[model samples]
Target: LAAGARGLLVAPSWSAPDHPARYEEWVTGLPVPTVLVERLGVPGGPLDEMDRVRSDHAHGVLLAVRHLFGLGHATPLLVARADSPTAQAVRAGYARALDVMGLRAPLPVLDSSSAERHPVLFEETARGLADAVRTGRATAALMHNDEDATWMVRRLAELDVRVPGDLALVTYDDEVAALADTPLTAVAPPKRAVGRRAAELLVERLTTPGAEAEPRVHLDLLPTLRVRASCGPPTSP
Candidate 1:
């Protein structure tokens, strides 16, 4: 409150599962006009109420699930951080996509929290993941990020398993995915556009605080899936 700041663009995601959401408290308490990135609005509510530059993660996850299923991979195991709001949203999208596609059996949402804890993922975690795949009979897996995909591939290699040939993989974030040994099929958001839009919103709010018809823009940028070798060739020979 004492800081000499004009405005703020925050990305304080929602709470963990079964936890209370604190967006309302934070937004109400902030002194200046603010905008939240990625996600920052209630359902069916006014977009201008809280300026934002949101990413449509739900739809992006749907595209990933559909892509895997279309490529003849039936069993999809979703791996994510247990406490991330983004992960929770992805899980919901995964479930919705499967249901809409009429898939009778629901896939598992694996916990990859270990990825964030130990800067370097542990061996036991990898072993446990491999075991989970065997136990769950998963043919394909979606990682929370490209880093997890790389870690899983290395761990699988140690266990004499190979990606695509053994377990097809898809990951989020295409930033560094192409550099992976096998290259990764990833979902990439319009990162630059997102940042630009968020900044623009803050600038607009700062410039016009009392205009009755001021613009209230809430954009949900669409993300694209970058296909590569990780999920294998699109068609079988």
Candidate 2:
């Protein structure tokens, strides 16, 4: 606290197991103002409890899933990080869409990494996914981010499968989606806008220092889906 640091624009990582607790402990008693960019350590709290700006990940996922569904994919699989709040929200959106569309019988989630430490499990998972695509059991798959999407596309290629021909891929996070070999279709979160809004809120809070009564600021930035060649028009069943 001796230095000239005024406030913090915080964005917690998905890797943090105790992100919320860490946030509370780190900023609760601090003398300076703080704002969280995405993912809170606390749950069920109102948006107004803290100064925060985050993307509406679930809605974005919903939009993408619906787009796939419109293309004749009733059973779209989601491959995600599995443990992140963002992933959970995306899963919920996928499930809700399936329910609304009156489709069931497909396992909707694929959370990578297993505790069994058995290579067979991963192998089986890969085989099953490849079979699903080849057999038209799953017409499309949604990856948590660009990296996973790229990895899956390459892996499928090794299986003698071609993306958009055998399977369609949509990914979250446009970060490196375009750089992929297939240039995946992906949800592009407003990263710059979220940061800009957080910075603005931090400045306001720092200047006021709770001098004037004000409502807490929370922003849920909407994301857009970037269509690319990875997604193909579905064939009629």
Candidate 3:
């Protein structure tokens, strides 16, 4: 350090498709005490030796799936993007949840990113998703993030697919989900807790001397599920 900063809170570019091979080495070799914030370092991997804090996205997926299942929906479809680390985590969690619940998705995981940014792709995905609901292929869906969920809902409405009526919906992020026409139920990740814990970890490492410092810690905060009108009343068997 030229900046004279004693410690660092690092959040790498996890949104990228892949990380460079030597990325871990670089972080480990840093001059100051470092703690990762919602970034790399999968458990049991090399990066697990580092201090980090992140949300338990898999647990979040479980919450969504259980909620849908409790509503009498056999298996809810997944609509997600592969654009971010969070999205990828949610996607993996969804698959794992299906396995744990002994349930299979009625349809394949739909690509929410396919509808992002491009109007044509958005319309196409909407129509496909609507067809799945209309034909009894999928009765409910777990969509990642608020924006894409909102977009899909608007397009689905145009095609005569209604939320909580023809299809139950649970979006991943709670950001603006409550503002949607149907006020979607959503999974709210512990973003604030992640940051706060990360900062505390960094400070802890900074204050503790070489021999006194605690072991490298990886903290995972569980997300909360917010129920709303979008999920509607339970379905009948």
Superposed model 2: Cα runs more than 4 Å off: 14-25, 46-48, 99-105, 113-125, 208-212
Q: Considering summed lDDT, which 10 consecutive residues are worst modelled in model 1?
A: 17-26
Clashes of each: 0, 1, 0
TM-score of 3: 0.92
Q: Candidate 1 overall Cα lDDT vs. reference?
A: 0.72
Alpha carbon lDDT at 127, candidate 1: 67
Error of 1 at 30 (Å): 1.8
lDDT for model 3 = 0.84
Ranking by TM-score: 3, 2, 1
Model 2, 1-237: lDDT tens per residue?
Answer: 588898887665556455566456555555667787876545653323667788888778877887888787766887776667676667666778667767673664766433235345445556667888777678788878676667778778889777888788899989999999888899998889988888888888778666324877668999999999899877665
lDDT of 3 by residue, 117-200 (tens): 677766767887999887888889999989889878888888898898889999997999999988999999999989999888
Against the true structure, candidate 1 reaches a TM-score of 0.82
What is the C-alpha lDDT profile of model 1 across 77-148, one tens digit per residue? Answer: 777765666777777777786778777433456667544566444465566668755664666777877777
How many Å off is the CA of 201 in candidate 1?
A: 1.8
Candidate 2, which ten residues in sequence have the lowest lDDT sum?
113-122
Give the TM-score comparing model 2 with the true structure, all chains together.
Answer: 0.84
Model 1 residue 140 CA deviation (Å) reads 1.1
